[model samples]
Structures are given as structure tokens and as C-alpha cells.
Target: MITNMRKPTFIVKQSLKIFCLLTGFAVMTWSFSFTKYIRGQFVNLNVLPERLKEYMYFMGRRLNGAYLSSLNKADNHDIPIIFIITPTYYRLVQKAELTRMANTLRLVKQLHWIIVEDFEVINLKTQEFFQSTGVSFTYFAQSKRSETNNHHRGADQRNAALDWIMVNHNPSMPAVIYFADDDNAYSLEIFQQMRYTKKLSMWPVGLSGGRTYETPILKDGKVIKFLAWKAEKRKFPIDMAGFALNANVLWTYKPMRFSTDADPGMLETKLLERCCTWAEIEPLADNCTKILVWHTRTEKPKVRMFDNVLEV
Candidate 1:
């Protein structure tokens, strides 16, 4: 009886050990699978820091002469174009402003201008100005501004321009697009510095009057962070005029449009949230260490109007 009892006890002990081992193995396998799933989710979301690191690694590895040579040929055949989207209202004061922008473009090569009027039709002076420049341009009017509930005409007009570009242009064409307000000052070197933009390019704008006059956070010739009061809550903080976008990214994410409903300082956050994070934005114009553009607001000119006479 004693021998038989010992034999049964040993068998039970061995069985328990085997069960624990099997359970441990299953738990480890499940943990590994869960980790992989989380990583996949991050990639799909295009979260800034991780995505930017991955892109940099890819660019570094592919930066060889053979790769560059092939890319050069391909780029020549399908050259990356630039489109400057400017939204304007019917203010007659903008004539000088538009002329300044036009003169700046003369220093930039191979750029397309998308000038949208926040009115029912383009006025004669605006039409004549564009025609006289002989620069590549597309003119359109968002006539429904007065009828719409939206008051942020700038954001709406920019979105319209983006929609127009996606609808009319080839998706594969290399292009860089930027929103240039009518009165802002642009530097010549800004365009040259943004030439090799892969995803998004950024530069510093002067006189923003935040913690930093410029928002570019640079370490080792790369943009690591953006310090802006506007995007303090968001993952990255940047001004609308501070960055440029690649056309492919825009086309790939077609319906990603700007929101006029975003509260005063939230427009940049809302737009960036739809696509990439701070990490995915590439730095250009030498990490914006040198001031290239100024975020100068138009000074309200003092003028006197008496019956039929106007004095400035």
C-alpha cells in the first residue's frame, strides 16, 4: 500500500510541473505578440518622434552616391515643384503687399503660385498684377465666404487651394507647398534652403514674440523640438508660416484639410494633428538658426478721408 501511494504522488508532482511550464510559455508568447501589435499601431499613427527617427535612419542609409545618382535622374524626370498658396481679401492696401511678394518670387525658381480671393471674383487690378508678372499661377475665388459661418477666411482659403492642387495635379509629382500670408516678409534664401525637403521643411520666423523669437529646436543640425506658446499642449509647437509640406504627403492624406473652427492659436495644432507629429518635420534653412523671414504684421496705416479727398 505504501509503495503504491508513493508512485501516485510522484506522478501528480510531475504533472503539476509540466502544467506550469506550459502556462509560462504561453504567457511569454502572448506578451511578445502584444508588443508587436503596439509597435504596428505606432507606425500607423505616424506619431512624430518615432516616425521622424525612422525616416532619418532610412535617409542616412540611403544617402550613398548610387542612391543619390538614381534619385537625381528620377527627380529631374519628375522634378519636385513648389506651390505658394496666398489668400487675399479685396483690401486695396494689399497692392504694395502683393508686389513685395511677387518681387520675392523672382529670386525663387520653378514655383507655382496659387492666389485665392476671398470674394466672388478676382478684381481687375489683381488679375492684371498676376498677368503682368508672367509667373506660373492659378487664380480662384472662394465666393461663399460671406455666406458661410466661417470667419477664419485664411484657413478656409488655404484649404481650398490645397483641394484644388490635389484635384488638378499628378499625385507623384514632387512638390513643396507653403501658405504665405499677403503681408508677411519672405527671404530669398528661404526657398533655396527648402529644396531637399522630403516630408516637411521648417525655418525660423522673426518677431513672433513667444518664448523664443524662433521656434526651431535644433541639435546636431536636425530639428528636435518646436517651442511655441500656440502648440504648448500639442506634441509640437510651430507657426503656420514656419513650415512647408511635401506634395506626396498632401496627396496621400487627401481629406486632411485645415479647420477654420480651431480657436485662435489652434489652427497649426489642428492641421498638424491630422497628419504628422513634431518628430516627422524635417529642419531646413540650417535649423533656422539664422533668421530668414519675419512674422511682421501689417501696420494699420493712419489715413484721413474727407468727403472726396483721402490723405495718408
Candidate 2:
């Protein structure tokens, strides 16, 4: 019995040896020192089993650390940092949205999250979640605003974010300001598109309304008409995700605030009133040919009214 078991054990040892040899050969072809590479990887050999925690260095560090490390190695010195201002209200899906957004933002280089809460005190849970993202972020708490109803407070929350940026940043800093709501589905290209906004850049927003998309009709590279049929009379009748402004635009227009009493969908229109003119609006995403953004709504989960979810 012992002799029979020896043959199988020997075969297993040979297989591991062959795997190590192949790995070493690949490393050598990549212009790495085979011995040194093996030494470093030896710490992780335990993941294959028959070894213990002392040999699990590869599993010791989180996988994202290696991903972030690679991002740092890329030539990104001049990529303008984007300040994502998200106005979020506390809700059942707030944390879920932020976590999902963080996963998206992690792939974006040189970005910061400025989350403004719609309540008085900073939510500790939200703050901790932001810190855990492994990205730069700032959390602020502001008073709620409601025009017709108490829940119509996103406009006020947005204004507070702008106010925070104005107070913290220099007027001439090289940054692009984007009002990114927590619940929207953003494409990675949105960051790349907004990085070079000289003044205010506008794009077509997908999944808006019940049609294909809402956009600014461009004629010879200028905004002629905002393409919306229902609410034809609003001033700047566009989605909040439809535009981005340069940092200088905010500095030039001091005390930029959203109107609480403005029409339900007039926040974007009213805010841009003091900011960008038609001539200054830069049409992007192939002059509104491609749709790269959507107002993705996450369906709220069903739970008991008095259920203490936090305790779970």
C-alpha cells in the first residue's frame, strides 16, 4: 500500500514542479529574474495547498491594491482631475448606490467624490463608506429644501455641493466640475469627455424620458434647440447629467445656488443661467451622435415599514 501511494505522490510533486517551471519560464521570457520571481511568488505557493498561513503573502494584500498600483504607473501627470459632486439623500438604497458608483470611479484616474448629504449632521455610515472606497472624497451635510413637497430637496443638496467647492478650491484651479447624482448610471467615457471642458460641455443623456434621448440640437456646432417635446417652455430644459462646467466657470459666477421655488425640472436651467452662454456651450460625444449616459433608476427593495435594517 505504501509503495502504491508513493507513485501517486511522486506524480503530484512532479506536476507542481512542472507548473513552477512553466511559470518561471514565462517570467524569464518577460525579462524578469527567474530566481527572484520564484522567491517572491514562493510566499504565495501555499494557495495551492499543503502549506499554511505563513506562506500566503499573495492573498495577504487585497486584489484592488494591485489594480490601483497599475493605475499609478500609467503616465497620468496632465490628466485634469474631475470633481464629482453627488447630492444624495439618505434612503434604503443610498449606500448601495455609493458602493456601486465607487467601483466605477475606481477605474477613473484623478477623480474626487464630493458627496453632499441633505440632512443636518453627517451620516457616519455614509462617511465611513466613502473612506472605504480607497479614493479621495469629501462629505458634507446641508439643510433640506422643498418647494412643493419635502422630498423635492435634491436641488438644495446640489447647491450646497457647489458652495463647498467654491469655499475649498482656488478660483483658478485646473479641475472640471460635474454634478453626478448617486443613482445615475455613468459610462467611463463620461469622465474622459468632461476632462477637457474649457467652459461648459453638454452631451446627450440616454434613458431620459420615454424616448431615445434628450439632447441639444447642434447646427454647425452650436446649440440651437434643447430636444424635449413635453416641457417646451422651461429655460434650460436638460437633464442634470447632461452638462459639465470648468472650475473657472464656478469662480467667475460667485454665489451659485439652485432655486428652491423654480419649476420642478428647472434646477439645471436656473443654475446654468448665471454660468454658461450658448456660445460657450461645448457639444461633445460626436456632436450628440453617441449616447453615453443614462438615468438608471434602482428599484427600491421591499421591506417592512418598521424593520430595523441597521441592526441587521
Evaluated against the true structure, the overall lDDT of model 2 is 0.71
Please list the C-alpha lDDT of all candidates, in the order they appear: 0.67, 0.71
- Over 1-312, each residue of candidate 1 has an lDDT whose tens digit, in order, gives 999899989999999999999999999987886444344432332333544433332222211111000011122344567788899865435667888888898567777888887765565546667667766777767654444465665777898888888876787667788888878888888877675678777877777745436577878766676666654465546677788888777766757788776766777777767777667778776666777877877775432311111110
Find the number of clashing residue pairs for candidate 1: 1
Worst 10 residues of 2 by lDDT: 62-71
The superposed Cα distance between candidate 2 and the true structure at residue 149, in angstroms, equals 9.8
Query: Could you tell me the TM-score of candidate 2?
Result: 0.70
User: TM-scores for all candidates?
Assistant: 0.69, 0.70
- Global CA lDDT computed for model 1: 0.67
